[model samples]
Target: MITSELLEKYTAVKKTFSKNETIFEEGNLPLYYYQIISGEIKMSNYNDDGREFIQGIFYKDQSFGEPPLFLNQKYPANAIAVEDSEIYMLPKANFMKLLEENPSISVKIIENLAQRLYYKSVMAAEMSTQEPEHRVLKLIDYGITHFDFKKDQNGYLINFTRQQIGDLTGLRVETVIRTIKALEKKGKLKIINRKVYR
Candidate 1:
């Protein structure tokens, strides 16, 4: 239950944030590692045009803030909660000790990082070879692998804003909107209130 003993040994702190709240800003000192207890946190970077490009989204049981642990510097991207969320914080030193004590956690962390890299590669490949519609489908497939994108009589239910989808898939917002509309027309997808039913 996040006891003081646990806090002393691991430098853990429990935090809750509301939707649209920034957990940590880019370029700020990366003093702690974070693990999501519940809800969604998005990691995003700013482009030259000052647009936010979503790098990744962390869900329940995911850990982030490890890049800074490796680099010994500030955060590369901003972490913001997409919904109300709880996270466990660990200072760098204590986190390393936990890794040393339990090697399996380290393995899981490495695997998570590898998966993130794989997603980026897939996005790049899709951008070069696939049409926008196919790209969206591929992304939905990936999400199904990672989350629960269930299909019913109507379609699949997937959570994401069109802008967020565009940010991750490297599609323009207009293109994403048009592609969703096309999918709806084709009877392959139905988007209602920002949720994709496919």
Candidate 2:
């Protein structure tokens, strides 16, 4: 993501959102490049039954919803604030201009987008064929590599909630709960004081 000062220079505006607020809905035309300054954001789609299928969770310093902006298409999923959050939004024209003026930044953006595509591909495969344990472990491994997970006495702390994990992995919450307990029994994870560590 672009630095705050640089983004500010490019006319990016900072905005705040309450927890659970919808930043943009699915199918809306993308007009801005969004980068989180604090807290979390999730991109998701809901089925007819209103069960959310999470596409990705993004944290501070991470960018979200860029694909649609780059492709000049409508968003495929909704972006929502996972907590009270601050974000920087740069108009599409300015964002494009910034990229053109800064090749290094453009390269970084491409790399970030590629990483997301890679994650989606991996998760899609896991959801289709992998066992529950395998899918859960794969997500934890990916988060360790890509996301900013906190570390504690036991190991890297898994910050995702059971419901969030279910949403992301296309599993039911009950299944996620059962899977985590099974993983703990197998020495794959630890559940200490209701928190999960890996």
Which candidate achieves the best lDDT against the true structure?
2
lDDT of 2 by residue, 115-180 (tens): 999999999999999999999999998998888798878999998999999998999999999999
User: What C-alpha lDDT does candidate 1 achieve relative to the native structure?
Assistant: 0.82
Candidate 1 lDDT over 74-145, as tens digits, reads 888999999999988888788778778867767877888788788889888998999999998888778878
Worst 10 residues of 2 by lDDT: 144-153
TM per candidate? 0.86, 0.98
- lDDT (CA) for every model shown? 0.82, 0.95
Q: Could you tell me how far off, in angstroms, the CA of residue 87 lies in candidate 1 after the best superposition? A: 0.9
For candidate 1, give the lDDT of residue 47: 91
